[model samples]
Target: MTCFAIARDDLTSPDVLDLLRLHLDEMHSWSPACKVHALPPEKLRAPDVTFYALRDGDRLAAVGALKVLGEGRGELKSMRAAPDYRGRGAGRALLEHLIAEARTRGLIWLGLETGRTVPFLPALRLYESHGFAESTGFGDYVPDEFSLCMELHL
Candidate 1:
């Protein structure tokens, strides 16, 4: 698929939210604990969160967001891809897009929180494959057995 990145404003468009809702529902169905944080549509308007939407033509197929946490650090959040687009490199595209965006913003490190469950193994692999390594919890995520933190130096 031909994919390109757009700002969070584009990703949070009404149509994009509908797609994200479906993605979240699918993840939730797989595991109740795999909760995708739901932000009011308005919350996505914040400048601190840099979101990238990968689209095929007019359809948004993947999305990922980077939240600046100061101290040359960034937190990855709200990463998901349309179910039909999985295994087609959409996830990797969105991730690499976000990593580039982070560096452009002067962030030296990028980190994220994901579940430690089996279903999240693929998610962990994606980050690991992209050069992210194990890291201590940062931002609002607390240290917990269920959470895995990974970071990559820019």
Candidate 2:
């Protein structure tokens, strides 16, 4: 079974920290330094952001966060499933949890920024399967070749 919770200490746990590092490294490798927007663990701790961890037994399977952008909108941030947990539904579970949370919070739109490169194809497919469609940039972001924006209107 999959279990998820609002991560408090998990964000600081070694396993989770390692996953975050891997995520950031992958982002930077795929996009230019200025276009890499994955937030660090400390940044995910902001009051407007809600972070979560997905666990399987005693293992940390995945991590994701939602940052509240005012005006009935929210942004997905730092979503990553450990390599060992890929194909085990961890990423999908985390995405579903965030989507449900957004709906419950009265957010009318949920958006995300991800790489436009081949390495990001899997993630792009996942979001698209979950009803997210490609969209123009929003919030503090501007349209950039290295980044692709997607949104799901609730």
Candidate 3:
């Protein structure tokens, strides 16, 4: 499979928004606990929230972000690969890229909230495979029955 680097401009491009919406809606259908709360693309213009979109040829294949929450802590948000793009290593690439970016910025730890529901096993496994371990809640996120918190030490 031919995989290309994700370009910065594509992150908020109108063309890629549909791909992101599809991925997010799929998550909602599959796991209610895995909700995306980023204020729409309009509000994502801030410097603290960095978003990326990976493309395969002209097709948008995956997307992810690093949201700086201050105090050397960051949150991983909107990590998703198009349905047809799964298993092609795009997801893994985006994740590893984001993690390395976070480390480069001097973050001590990176955290994420995913579903504890039945449908999220694959996502949980991906995070664990990448060295993220179970962790206590950070940020405004609380310990909810339907969610699980995971973190990686840099």
Candidate 4:
């Protein structure tokens, strides 16, 4: 994680909560409330999900999560880099950490649901660069104009 420390977070830190609130607020601004699927802090604390936080010294750098969706599949969620950490390696470091963690957990496939719109282009590109390919919706997700589903066969 370079200069950043990455760890399994309990989602209770004020910084983590602030980031999640910012994430949800950003999602709502980009899409309708119903189309925004970003999970809240309480939901991210579910047993099936593991939340990670990256920190530079005592400052929050980024946050991300992985959810075991059964049958050797995992889902990425709540990926967000702090405003100060944007354009830095923080986001990539956290993403790489999560991907590696997913593999370590014996996940055969990693997938995610994200918005399909201008605000989400950078995120889409990042996932694509990491080998996530556009795919049909999974789990309870439905294909819609506001949604984009992607997967990577591990």
Candidate number achieving the greatest lDDT relative to the actual structure: 4
Give the TM-scores of the predictions, in the order they appear.
Answer: 0.84, 0.93, 0.86, 0.96
What residue runs in model 2 are displaced by over 4 Å at the alpha carbon?
A: 1-10
Q: Which ten residues in a row have the lowest lDDT in candidate 2?
A: 1-10
lDDT of 2 by residue, 20-69 (tens): 99999988888899998899988998999988888877888889999999
Give the candidates in order of lDDT, highest first. Answer: 4, 2, 3, 1
Least well predicted 10-residue stretch by lDDT in candidate 3: 31-40
lDDT tens digits, residue span 1-154, model 1: 4656555555547767876677567556654443344343445546887667778778777877788888998888778878777878888888888898889989999988777678778888999999998888776665466667788999
Candidate 2 lDDT (Cα, 0 to 1): 0.87
Query: lDDT per model, in order?
Result: 0.75, 0.87, 0.78, 0.92
Please write out the lDDT profile of model 4 over residues 1-154, one tens digit for every residue.
3599999999988999999999999999999988889999989999999999999999999999999999999999999999999878888888899999999999999999999999888888889989999999898877689999999998
Worst 10 residues of 4 by lDDT: 136-145
Winner by TM-score: 4
lDDT of 3 by residue, 11-111 (tens): 55766687766766766676553343434554455688888888888887888888898889898887888878887888888899989899999999899
User: TM-score of the candidate numbered 1?
Assistant: 0.84
Count of clashes in candidate 2: 0
Which has the higher TM-score value, candidate number 1 or candidate number 2? 2
- Please report how far candidate 3 places residue 128 from its true position, in Å: 0.4
For model 2, name the residue pairs that clash. Answer: none
